[model samples]
Target: MQNVYLAATSATPEVDFRFDSHRMSLKGESYPENAQAFYGPLLDAVGSYLAACRGTTIQIDVQLAYFNSSSTKLLMSLFEQFNQAALAGNHVLVNWFHDEEDDTILEFGEEIAEDYPALELLTQALV
Candidate 1:
Protein backbone atom coordinates (compact mmCIF):
# COMPACT_ATOMS: atom_id res chain seq x y z
CA MET A 1 0.00 0.00 0.00
CA GLN A 2 1.08 3.56 -0.74
CA ASN A 3 1.94 5.99 2.02
CA VAL A 4 -0.65 8.52 3.16
CA TYR A 5 0.28 12.12 3.86
CA LEU A 6 -2.20 14.87 4.66
CA ALA A 7 -1.06 18.41 5.25
CA ALA A 8 -2.26 20.24 8.33
CA THR A 9 -4.84 22.99 8.08
CA SER A 10 -6.10 25.58 10.51
CA ALA A 11 -8.81 23.19 11.63
CA THR A 12 -7.04 19.90 11.09
CA PRO A 13 -3.88 18.05 11.98
CA GLU A 14 -1.21 16.69 9.64
CA VAL A 15 -1.22 12.94 9.01
CA ASP A 16 1.90 11.13 7.87
CA PHE A 17 1.63 7.39 7.37
CA ARG A 18 4.66 5.63 5.92
CA PHE A 19 3.81 2.26 4.47
CA ASP A 20 7.42 1.08 4.13
CA SER A 21 8.45 1.96 7.68
CA HIS A 22 5.15 1.29 9.40
CA ARG A 23 5.52 4.64 11.07
CA MET A 24 2.70 7.13 11.38
CA SER A 25 2.47 10.58 12.91
CA LEU A 26 -0.45 12.92 13.56
CA LYS A 27 0.42 16.43 14.60
CA GLY A 28 -1.04 19.90 15.05
CA GLU A 29 -4.64 20.70 15.97
CA SER A 30 -7.73 18.74 14.93
CA TYR A 31 -11.30 20.04 14.82
CA PRO A 32 -12.35 19.32 11.31
CA GLU A 33 -15.89 20.23 10.25
CA ASN A 34 -16.49 16.70 9.00
CA ALA A 35 -14.56 14.29 11.12
CA GLN A 36 -15.66 11.22 9.18
CA ALA A 37 -14.72 12.76 5.88
CA PHE A 38 -11.27 13.46 7.23
CA TYR A 39 -10.62 10.24 9.13
CA GLY A 40 -12.50 7.51 7.26
CA PRO A 41 -9.98 6.91 4.52
CA LEU A 42 -7.09 7.25 6.93
CA LEU A 43 -8.55 4.58 9.18
CA ASP A 44 -9.24 2.32 6.22
CA ALA A 45 -5.67 2.61 5.03
CA VAL A 46 -4.31 1.86 8.49
CA GLY A 47 -6.59 -1.17 8.87
CA SER A 48 -5.46 -2.47 5.51
CA TYR A 49 -1.82 -1.99 6.43
CA LEU A 50 -2.19 -3.76 9.77
CA ALA A 51 -4.01 -6.62 8.11
CA ALA A 52 -1.10 -7.07 5.75
CA CYS A 53 1.66 -6.67 8.30
CA ARG A 54 3.76 -9.74 9.09
CA GLY A 55 5.07 -9.40 12.65
CA THR A 56 6.49 -5.98 11.85
CA THR A 57 6.74 -3.30 14.48
CA ILE A 58 4.47 -0.33 13.93
CA GLN A 59 5.13 3.02 15.53
CA ILE A 60 2.54 5.75 15.89
CA ASP A 61 3.32 9.19 17.19
CA VAL A 62 0.51 11.56 18.10
CA GLN A 63 1.14 15.23 18.83
CA LEU A 64 -2.13 17.06 18.77
CA ALA A 65 -2.28 20.37 20.58
CA TYR A 66 -6.04 20.25 20.40
CA PHE A 67 -8.76 17.98 19.07
CA ASN A 68 -12.53 18.12 19.29
CA SER A 69 -14.82 15.38 20.65
CA SER A 70 -15.47 14.00 17.20
CA SER A 71 -11.77 13.74 16.61
CA THR A 72 -11.42 12.01 19.95
CA LYS A 73 -13.85 9.29 18.91
CA LEU A 74 -11.96 8.81 15.68
CA LEU A 75 -8.71 8.53 17.60
CA MET A 76 -10.24 5.95 19.92
CA SER A 77 -11.22 3.84 16.95
CA LEU A 78 -7.78 4.21 15.47
CA PHE A 79 -6.21 3.05 18.70
CA GLU A 80 -8.53 0.09 18.75
CA GLN A 81 -6.97 -0.99 15.49
CA PHE A 82 -3.56 -0.69 17.05
CA ASN A 83 -4.66 -2.80 19.99
CA GLN A 84 -5.99 -5.51 17.74
CA ALA A 85 -2.89 -5.49 15.60
CA ALA A 86 -0.63 -5.78 18.62
CA LEU A 87 -2.73 -8.56 20.12
CA ALA A 88 -2.35 -10.43 16.85
CA GLY A 89 1.44 -10.67 17.45
CA ASN A 90 2.77 -7.58 15.66
CA HIS A 91 4.60 -5.15 17.91
CA VAL A 92 2.86 -1.78 18.10
CA LEU A 93 4.15 1.27 19.85
CA VAL A 94 2.14 4.43 20.37
CA ASN A 95 3.90 7.57 21.47
CA TRP A 96 1.39 10.16 22.58
CA PHE A 97 2.83 13.64 22.89
CA HIS A 98 1.21 16.45 24.80
CA ASP A 99 2.18 19.98 25.63
CA GLU A 100 3.70 20.38 29.09
CA GLU A 101 0.96 22.77 30.15
CA ASP A 102 -1.85 20.56 28.88
CA ASP A 103 -2.66 17.99 31.52
CA THR A 104 -5.87 17.15 29.72
CA ILE A 105 -4.06 15.74 26.74
CA LEU A 106 -1.80 13.72 28.98
CA GLU A 107 -4.74 12.37 30.88
CA PHE A 108 -6.44 11.54 27.63
CA GLY A 109 -3.45 9.48 26.61
CA GLU A 110 -3.59 7.66 29.90
CA GLU A 111 -7.20 6.80 29.27
CA ILE A 112 -6.39 5.42 25.88
CA ALA A 113 -3.54 3.43 27.35
CA GLU A 114 -5.89 1.90 29.86
CA ASP A 115 -8.39 1.02 27.18
CA TYR A 116 -5.81 -0.51 24.85
CA PRO A 117 -3.60 -2.26 27.32
CA ALA A 118 -2.32 -4.73 24.78
CA LEU A 119 -0.56 -2.05 22.78
CA GLU A 120 2.58 -0.36 24.01
CA LEU A 121 1.48 3.18 24.84
CA LEU A 122 3.93 5.82 25.94
CA THR A 123 3.01 9.37 26.85
CA GLN A 124 5.62 12.09 26.57
CA ALA A 125 5.65 15.82 27.12
CA LEU A 126 6.29 17.78 23.97
CA VAL A 127 9.56 19.71 23.89
Candidate 2:
Protein backbone atom coordinates (compact mmCIF):
# COMPACT_ATOMS: atom_id res chain seq x y z
CA MET A 1 0.00 0.00 0.00
CA GLN A 2 1.06 3.57 -0.67
CA ASN A 3 1.82 6.02 2.16
CA VAL A 4 0.25 9.44 2.76
CA TYR A 5 2.06 12.68 3.45
CA LEU A 6 -0.02 15.87 3.47
CA ALA A 7 1.53 19.21 4.29
CA ALA A 8 -0.38 21.51 6.58
CA THR A 9 -1.61 24.72 5.00
CA SER A 10 -3.91 27.40 6.32
CA ALA A 11 -6.87 25.10 5.86
CA THR A 12 -5.45 21.78 6.96
CA PRO A 13 -3.10 20.05 9.35
CA GLU A 14 0.19 18.39 8.49
CA VAL A 15 -0.36 14.73 7.79
CA ASP A 16 2.80 12.58 7.81
CA PHE A 17 1.98 8.92 7.54
CA ARG A 18 4.52 6.29 6.63
CA PHE A 19 3.39 2.78 5.89
CA ASP A 20 6.75 1.10 5.94
CA SER A 21 7.70 2.69 9.25
CA HIS A 22 4.20 2.60 10.71
CA ARG A 23 4.63 6.16 11.97
CA MET A 24 1.83 8.69 11.62
CA SER A 25 1.95 12.29 12.71
CA LEU A 26 -0.49 15.19 12.44
CA LYS A 27 0.54 18.68 13.42
CA GLY A 28 -0.68 22.28 13.03
CA GLU A 29 -3.98 24.14 13.20
CA SER A 30 -7.06 22.86 11.37
CA TYR A 31 -10.18 24.84 10.71
CA PRO A 32 -10.98 23.90 7.18
CA GLU A 33 -14.26 24.96 5.63
CA ASN A 34 -14.74 21.35 4.50
CA ALA A 35 -13.32 19.14 7.19
CA GLN A 36 -14.59 15.91 5.71
CA ALA A 37 -13.12 16.72 2.36
CA PHE A 38 -9.71 17.16 3.92
CA TYR A 39 -9.81 14.24 6.33
CA GLY A 40 -11.93 11.67 4.58
CA PRO A 41 -9.24 10.60 2.17
CA LEU A 42 -6.63 10.52 4.88
CA LEU A 43 -8.85 8.31 6.99
CA ASP A 44 -9.35 6.07 4.02
CA ALA A 45 -5.61 5.81 3.57
CA VAL A 46 -5.10 4.96 7.21
CA GLY A 47 -7.75 2.29 7.06
CA SER A 48 -6.16 0.77 4.02
CA TYR A 49 -2.74 0.84 5.64
CA LEU A 50 -4.04 -0.82 8.77
CA ALA A 51 -5.82 -3.46 6.80
CA ALA A 52 -2.66 -4.33 4.92
CA CYS A 53 -0.47 -4.12 7.98
CA ARG A 54 -1.81 -7.37 9.37
CA GLY A 55 -1.67 -6.45 13.07
CA THR A 56 1.31 -4.12 12.81
CA THR A 57 1.74 -1.46 15.42
CA ILE A 58 0.33 1.96 14.48
CA GLN A 59 1.83 4.89 16.31
CA ILE A 60 -0.15 8.09 15.89
CA ASP A 61 1.08 11.41 17.14
CA VAL A 62 -1.38 14.30 17.23
CA GLN A 63 -0.14 17.82 17.73
CA LEU A 64 -2.76 20.48 17.21
CA ALA A 65 -2.74 24.18 17.85
CA TYR A 66 -6.43 24.76 17.26
CA PHE A 67 -9.30 23.01 15.55
CA ASN A 68 -12.94 23.74 14.78
CA SER A 69 -15.95 21.62 15.56
CA SER A 70 -15.81 19.77 12.27
CA SER A 71 -12.16 18.97 12.68
CA THR A 72 -12.93 17.89 16.22
CA LYS A 73 -15.40 15.41 14.85
CA LEU A 74 -12.80 14.13 12.45
CA LEU A 75 -10.39 13.69 15.32
CA MET A 76 -12.95 11.67 17.22
CA SER A 77 -13.36 9.42 14.26
CA LEU A 78 -9.62 8.88 14.01
CA PHE A 79 -9.30 8.02 17.67
CA GLU A 80 -12.20 5.66 17.39
CA GLN A 81 -10.31 3.88 14.66
CA PHE A 82 -7.40 3.45 17.02
CA ASN A 83 -9.64 2.07 19.71
CA GLN A 84 -11.24 -0.42 17.36
CA ALA A 85 -7.93 -1.54 15.89
CA ALA A 86 -6.46 -2.09 19.33
CA LEU A 87 -9.52 -3.95 20.55
CA ALA A 88 -9.22 -6.24 17.57
CA GLY A 89 -5.71 -7.26 18.68
CA ASN A 90 -3.79 -4.74 16.63
CA HIS A 91 -1.14 -2.74 18.44
CA VAL A 92 -2.13 0.93 18.35
CA LEU A 93 -0.68 3.78 20.33
CA VAL A 94 -1.82 7.38 20.46
CA ASN A 95 0.21 10.28 21.77
CA TRP A 96 -1.40 13.69 22.13
CA PHE A 97 0.99 16.61 22.55
CA HIS A 98 0.04 20.00 23.89
CA ASP A 99 1.75 23.21 24.84
CA GLU A 100 2.46 23.10 28.54
CA GLU A 101 0.84 26.48 29.06
CA ASP A 102 -2.25 25.56 27.09
CA ASP A 103 -4.74 24.12 29.52
CA THR A 104 -7.38 23.84 26.85
CA ILE A 105 -5.20 21.52 24.84
CA LEU A 106 -4.46 19.42 27.88
CA GLU A 107 -8.13 19.16 28.68
CA PHE A 108 -8.90 18.17 25.13
CA GLY A 109 -6.31 15.42 25.29
CA GLU A 110 -7.76 14.20 28.56
CA GLU A 111 -11.22 14.18 27.09
CA ILE A 112 -10.00 12.15 24.15
CA ALA A 113 -8.29 9.75 26.52
CA GLU A 114 -11.49 9.30 28.45
CA ASP A 115 -13.54 8.78 25.35
CA TYR A 116 -11.30 6.02 24.03
CA PRO A 117 -10.36 3.89 26.96
CA ALA A 118 -9.55 0.89 24.84
CA LEU A 119 -6.50 2.53 23.25
CA GLU A 120 -3.57 3.77 25.25
CA LEU A 121 -3.49 7.57 25.09
CA LEU A 122 -0.48 9.42 26.43
CA THR A 123 -0.08 13.16 27.00
CA GLN A 124 3.11 15.05 26.30
CA ALA A 125 3.68 18.66 27.34
CA LEU A 126 5.55 20.70 24.78
CA VAL A 127 8.39 22.85 25.91
Q: Whose TM-score is greatest here?
A: 1
* Local accuracy of candidate 1 as per-residue lDDT tens digits, 1-127: 9999989999999999997888999999999999999999999999999999878899999999999999999999999998999999999999999998899999999999999998899999977
What lDDT would candidate 2 get against the real structure?
0.85
Candidate 2, 1-127: lDDT as tens digits: 7878888899788999887898889999999999999989988887777666657778889999888889888988888877777777778788999998999888988888898887778999999
Cα error of candidate 2 at position 49, Å: 1.6
Q: Candidate 1: TM-score?
A: 0.97
Candidate 2 Cα outliers beyond 4 Å, as residue runs = none
**TM-score for all predictions?**
0.97, 0.93
Pairs in clash, predicted candidate 2: none
User: Model 2 clash tally?
Assistant: 0
Relative to the true structure, how large is the alpha-carbon lDDT of every model?
0.93, 0.85
